[model samples]
Target: CLGKEVGADIPFCVYQKVARVRGIGDIVEPFKLKVGYDVLLIKPKQGVDTKIAFEILDLDKCPHPDINQVKKALINNEPLKDILGNSLLYSAEKLVPEILDIIKECKERGYEDVVMTGSGSTVFVLLEKGQDCRDLIKFMEGKYPFVYRTSILIK
Candidate 1:
């Protein structure tokens, strides 16, 4: 794993719900999710720089979701409605306005668990378990530069 090669103590290299002690290279632990969610990731031509994203972030206005609540929701397979959100979404959306349009499009299509992953332009729509996203992927591929169908890594 890159974390191990870099001398960071961590259990996994890549996965969701990963908690780092002091961010990135710090002590990291990957939390296992009970239910795997089929997801459609759509990214526009524009990309947001991670550093610039964080630099413009306003913690005062951005959401501060409870990490513990998010972890519990994932582990217990609970509905993610008010509990899951990204702190960097505000800054990312500011950098790339396409992010908002993508999210709105997803919600308009009846997908509720839409969120901007990490720092940028790529937005993901979490589908119900075992739900097929081929139609969504096909629709998104026509609009966005990059559209992919993937799932959460649940162990």
Candidate 2:
């Protein structure tokens, strides 16, 4: 309940499992999702205001991914690229150039579906099964102070 007032993503983060958030961030439905890979979280030097990001989001320039499709892909264990190709906060990249830079860098390094997590700054790239991200991490070592190899919490 506290998470709702703090941020929409917080509730989902607290659940730490596959979930479908509905009804203006009040409803959270947890479910089983067969996820096969971990995520690389890269935090840039800059940060963004969640309120400002939402306020300035341009639907035309930054498109929101279809939530149903994302849920279906996760449940079906689809290709990592297909399952995580889009981001709800992608449009916020326009407001924060650093976010866009990180996305571009991740793509150039063969990382797919690189998106800013939650509101800003922190970006995550999905790593496929058996794929090693050491090189990518090394590449980002000096550039970004916070880079973590992490997986979603399954409940």
Candidate 3:
């Protein structure tokens, strides 16, 4: 959903609850602290450029640390601005609102923890317990078109 329009696909590793191993429809084992759901492992495409996965994102076109923009830029698949001279971002304050809005929306939707990953344009939320991330993806299928290439994010 989130990557459908962007061409990026969100490959998740789902684990169905072990307790409900005998059910046709999905069921929740609230008492189980670590209930497993169906699992789906998604690996990114190969040959992709180095991303902010575990690297620094130099986007302010300078030197500093605006982790948010770095994350956003990565999500947008924008080139990482090398921090050669100085300055981390050109106008981070101006762009922060957009990131905040994304985070806010996730919260409104009931995500317990939403964080901007590395110095990339991607914003992720680790939910406590509620709706499927797929539903959220379906909801955000349009807003970001550049994220589709994420399949190759760490390639």
Question: How does model 3 fare in lDDT?
Answer: 0.36
The residue-by-residue lDDT of candidate 2 on 1-155, one tens digit each, is 88889977777777776688886566888878675668899987778776777676666865556777877877787754554534446655666677777888989988876777766678988776557889889988878888889776656
Clash pairs, candidate 1, are none
Worst 10 residues of 3 by lDDT: 39-48
lDDT of 1 by residue, 6-35 (tens): 644343344445343335545566666766
The TM-score obtained by model 2 is 0.82
Off by over 4 Å in 1: 1-22
- Among residues 3 or more apart in sequence or in different chains, the pairs in candidate 2 whose N, CA or C atoms overlap within 3 Å are none
Model 2 has a clash total of 0
Which stretches of model 3 miss by more than 4 angstroms? Answer: 1-93, 128-131, 146-155
Model 1 root-mean-square deviation? 3.3
Candidate 2: C-alpha RMSD after superposition: 2.4
Ranking by lDDT: 1, 2, 3
Q: Model 3: how far is 13 from its true place, Å?
A: 17
